[model samples]
Target: MKKLTLFASAFLLSLGSYAQQALWGGTNLVSPQINEDKTVTFRIHAPKASKVEIEGDFLPPTKVDTPFGPQDIPSRAPFKEGKNGVWEYTSSVLPSELYSYSLYVNDLKMPDPNNVYQNRDIATMTNIFLIGGGQADNYMVQEVPHGTVAKVWYSSPGLGMEARRMTVYTPAGYESSKKKYPVLYLLHGAGGDENAWTELGRAAQILDNLIAQGKAEPMIVVMPNGNGAQEAAPGEAPNSMVKPSFMNPKTMDGAIEKAFPDVMKYIEKNYRVYTDKNHRAIAGLSMGGFHSLYISAYYPNKFGYVGLFSAATSKQVNKGVTSDVYENLEDKLAVQFKNAPKLYWIGIGKTDFLYKDNMDFRKILDNNGYKYTYMETDGGHIWKNWRIYLTEFVPLLFK
Candidate 1:
């Protein structure tokens, strides 16, 4: 009798696992189906629970990353209790390009067994929702004029890493056309990898739109792994935490100067790229931004245009008055401005925590008689503002 009972328990467990797998088979529970009313419905049938609601980045113009973009729908509607004794709720959200959401019961974030688009990149599973089903043209890998995206690997002697790989997006007509194109070295932020710009920033689409509109010159964009550690960028093992390393010039110089030059030499020799300072540009976000500032200044002759977007420039913090990121390096950086670089552009959101730093940096430049452009918009440190900044900054490159 005990043997029979054990067999029954094992069979039941296997059946439950199969059922769970089937539930998340198709669309994934995280991607809610958009009803004709333009309303989104998120359902979790935990009927035992007294309360439940949906939360996510449904609202627009709101901070998504920092404040955490999620909203709780009031549970006024009666939840239909499923056979498994679970409750569910559906809510509507205004349309947008993309969003992230999840079910929260009381305060715990619950996973949707029915939704398949759930991303478990973070420790807690989060639901990913896309409302406006546009081409995401900004993020698409295109075949126009024929640009090639190659995943290539290299060894970095500076950081003592072997087999470091990155994505290089060559513009259309790169293969057939003998014309050498300008290169834009773009960097991603913290919690992002080499593919961040291509995936989330819609980099190709932005470049396509700009080129088509005659707003910007067509160029190759090299997205490198900003983290010194090799495993970090690919989400592989041996991942190292990314911190603000711009304050320490020794480390920044070692990584950017020695390690990055290897990437440049490899590109120039293999690809049909322009090998001059006038055709080279570098820009980045957050930690990448600090790298941009210091890297450009340190090696002024290497790049012509520099862009900083929503960056953390200093280790020192200011309540609302000033930033020390550029304070110590002011005199040395001024020499870079005096010597090379056609365009030195800095972009930041007014409400961003780094706003004061940006403003203070601008003042330092102004005080030093440096000619640069400063862009101020309404936003915090988020991708929305960075997207806008990229659109604006790319056009000014190689001009």
Candidate 2:
């Protein structure tokens, strides 16, 4: 037994010796290393690659003409070769915001292999990092109390899916206490699922920081999958592991709007929440913005606070009887405003593709003398703008 134990110990030592060779610290190379001067240095070890470029939103924007309008897109910067085929580039002083980027080697686009921090937008994945000391400071996990986010499954009878998934976030101290909290039904844009807001938009982190600071009221946030045919996000449902797309059937055709009650019912029944309109808020970005608009209007008096961020006011496809949800918008808005919601907030980027559509929708409200707050920012339909909108919008809820 002593000999066997000694042999086992020797074998473990041998394995440990081999493990150190394939570890992370050996490279001493960091793709994104934040500097004291606020500039970020990115390094990639690709001695064989001839040309390399860093593509991220932090760089200066270049104007690109599209069908919607000319928009400022993220431009790339060349990486100079360093010692030992290590390509490196130091960025200019960057503002405090969550940034995402990809690397191009010889014109082929790919995520930074060195940076394990990444996010998925539709079928594409890009590395993400946060620069602290500004709005993005809220995006980072601080020493304050944190919230609990869970992937829950509930039955949605209307969609004919017996069990569907949703992302629910409960604020800190929720479990220890029995108090009921206001609910914010935060929806995601197209190509996003229940995971979008929490992952890409930093919803959980923002809420935790805001609630801790007492700047925002503690509230329960529910993120539901807007796609009707999809039981959940890609790979989340049984036998449905496929690449995510921006558009899906039955999402905007009123089926989701009709079926939205299932999500609320589940939340109200299973979680400790206030079931009144005054305690309810619904908000989304882009496609999610459209959903929030129609759902709140269609079920007028359901939510007291409504927010649309870079919302796409049009592009509703007709799918049989489900198309009625898209119709009679003026009438629906009339009914919705009759009760005079506590807040009707709208925000969009100046260069957003749906800026005009949002404006057209606003004009309808303007013509009808409806009361709503509007905020416009600089940028297109991207996550940077959406994160800013969320941080701005949530503080004003349930005040």
The model with the greatest lDDT is: 2
What is candidate 2's CA lDDT for residue 121? 88
- What's the number of clashes in each of the models? 19, 0
Task: Report the C-alpha lDDT of model 1 over 194-281, residue by residue, as the tens digit.
Answer: 7668666768777876776578888999888776655334344355443423232233333553467877877888877888889999
Give lDDT per model, in order. Answer: 0.67, 0.90
Candidate 1 — worst ten consecutive residues by lDDT sum? Answer: 67-76
Worst 10 residues of 2 by lDDT: 315-324
TM-score per model over all chains: 0.73, 0.93
lDDT of candidate 2 over 214-279, digit per residue (tens) = 999999999999999888999988988887887887777778989999999999999999999999
| TM-score of model 2 vs. true structure | 0.93
Q: How accurate is candidate 2 locally (lDDT)?
A: 0.90
